[model samples]
Each structure stands twice: as C-alpha cells, then as structure tokens.
Target: MELRKSGSAVWSPASDWRRGSTVRWLLLSVGLGWISLFDSTLWSQTKEVVLPRGTDVSVMKKDILLFEKILDVKLSHIPNAMLAVVDRTKGVYLKGYGIVLTFLVNINRVVITTPFGERPVGKRQTAEEKRRRIHEIREMLIQALKDNPGSFKQLTPSDAVVIVAHFEDSNELDDAKRHKTIVLKVFKRDLDVYKTNGYEKFKQQVVIDEY
Candidate 1:
C-alpha cells in the first residue's frame, strides 16, 4: 500500500488500530476532513483502554493484518479501501487497509456526438457530485451484502467488520461479495443510527436495507 505524508496515507490495518484512542480521534477527524486541525498533544494524553479478559490484542492485530492483505488482493483495482472490525465480544474498530481518500473524483471518457461530428470527451465529476455518488454506492453495497448471505460465510468470532470504499459501479457489489473480503457493509444512515441509537441498535439495523 502507498503511504502519503500530508495526513493522507495508506495505513496498515494492524498498526493503525493499535494506537488506541488518539488514533481513533485522528481517523475520525480525517474522515470528517478535519485533519488540518488535529491536535498532536492528544497523542500523549491518550490512554490505552483494557479489553475483556479473553480478548487477545496480538491475535486481533494479526487477524486484521491478514484481512487487510486479502482485501488488498481482492480490491486491488480500487484505489481506496477501508476496514471496519466488529467484534461480538468487543466493539467496532475502523482501519484503513490500503489507500483511502477524503475526496473522490470520477474521470471517464465518453463519446459525445456534436453537431458536426462525434468525438470522445473526458468528463470529470465535481467533489459534490462525487460525494452524492459515493453515498449511493455505499447504500448499494450494503443492500447487496444484505441480499447475499454467502458473502459473509467466512466470518468467525475473531472476524468482525470489514468494509471498503469505492466509486459506484454496477458490478462492484457482486465482485466484493465474490471476493469475500468484507463480512458486513454499512451505509451513512447506519452510521447515524450508530451514533444516535447506540451500538446494539446499530448492529440490529446494519443488515437491513435502507434504500
């Protein structure tokens, strides 16, 4: 995975999640496009929280790394990949297995027939357009996952949440399920539920199609 220096980097799933609360806050800030305002002092102030008696941090980290590798191979064509680890015993943890971007732009070449002749035109989607499209993509992916139970067959107790982000394509939802890199898919509405209703309620509503 390629790593960038200006707050946008291809973070390994293992190392990214192991940094504790401060890293979580940083990731949240990054997701919200607030990376510029991230406080470095919070790193020193952050404390590691203890897990349950049976939760093995090392094992979890190793599993996450393996999952990252699988996702990297499966979604190699996509430029951005994000993982969310949902533990039945523990809570959900979000990480980036590969390159993930705050902004997405879709550029494509299309044949446009003008008044005189037909020629290929390159079209670039604006940030707002891309954002709306991505939102729809997330919803489609979640619906696809809900419809296919076989996609999540590999998930065990150790494996929790696994998600990836990419532009909306007709074949991508099916391709991800066939690749088996993700266990559960969540959309923006689900995240709202997670924040407002709480984790248990979030899990209950995760698999339900909101479209």
Candidate 2:
C-alpha cells in the first residue's frame, strides 16, 4: 500500500510514524482495483472506520485514533454501576460500502442508574421513558461529536456517522446485544456543520434517528 501525508506527499513509515504505534493500513491489492479483502477478524477489528474510495491511509488512521480518543474522553463516565461505549466501537456495512460508522454505547445500567434511581428500562420501557433515554443518549453523542473536524475528514459526503446505545444487562448477553437500544445517524456533510457553523447550529442540524 502507498501512504500519503495530508499534503499528498508520499509517506515513509520510518520517516513519518512515531514510536509505540501499530499500522493496520488498508491493504491495496495490485490489479484488484480498490477492493478491500476482509474476513471476520478484520471486519471485527476495522468496523469502527468506514472508509471511502481514495481514502488517505495516513490521515484516516490518525484521524480515526483521534475520534476514538474523543469517544474515550467524552463518554468516560460511570453512573451507578457504569455508562460507557461497551469495550470498543462497532459498526455495520450498509447496502453500499464504506458509508457508515455505528458506535455502541452501553446504556443498560446508564438508564437505570439515574439521578432519581434505577428507573426500569428495556422491555418495560414506557413511551416517555424510551423517549427520555433516546434523547439523553443522542444529546450525549452530540457532545461527543463536538469540535472535531478531523473525525469527519476521511468520510465522504455520502458517508455517515452512526451511534448505537445498547441497553445491555450486567450478566445477560442477549438483552445486552438485542433487547433495547437506540441508533442515531447523520451524514458527514451534515456533521461538518460544526466546522463552519457553531455548536448550537450544528447540534440542531444533526438529525437524531430513533434516539
């Protein structure tokens, strides 16, 4: 694979990379066009980043790590037992390729451990409770997206950012992955509003899909 800096100059690992880092540069197969080869393991590891055609390897990798750092700091809070993005970020492919990123936030205990107390969520969710939880998580994700133009630089105008809040239980696995959750997505074009406009306008510009 050929690497290029943001200046579009060729990047040499020995000259460019700092120490204590690992490279998972997207493999570019000769004569294979722009196809990405992936098995289960690669998919699991790389799902956080949704790459577009002509993606910048050096810039994208650096910016992905930056987005991850933001996610770490912004969502690094424990209420009662906890509130976090599970272990790591996860994503799914759309019908198209390299157009999405879905981050799973563990909101199981987050919904329960509240200022009032553990309000029952999951299957017992009333419409109001569901709305409240969804809105709360959406706002939190909005906060997570703030002031980071780097995060969206690698994404195309057609690509998007998706945040999923999984209402997971402490021990139960199925409920954790399947039972209750909220998914919010916005196009990177819309997300880039923060760069030109301010946070207030950008927040309103983001469309919260199903909490």
TM-score top scorer: 2
Lowest summed lDDT across 10 adjacent residues in model 2 is found at 19-28
Cα error, residue 46 of model 1, in Å, equals 42
Per-residue CA lDDT of candidate 2, range 1-211, in tens?
A: 5666667566677655633233323233332433344455577888878765676667766666666666656556533223435665544444333334445555444245668887654444344654565566567777776666557676777677666655544534564333465565667777665656766777776666551
CA deviation > 4 Å runs, candidate 2: 1-53, 81-85, 91-99, 103-134, 169-178, 194-200
Q: Which pairs in model 1 have colliding backbones? A: 84-161, 86-161
- In angstroms, the error of model 2 at 81 is 6.4
Give the deviation of candidate 2 from the true structure as CA RMSD: 23.6
Per-model CA lDDT versus the true structure: 0.40, 0.57
TM-score between candidate 2 and the true structure: 0.49
Clashes of 1: 2
Q: Scored by Cα lDDT, where does model 1 land?
A: 0.40
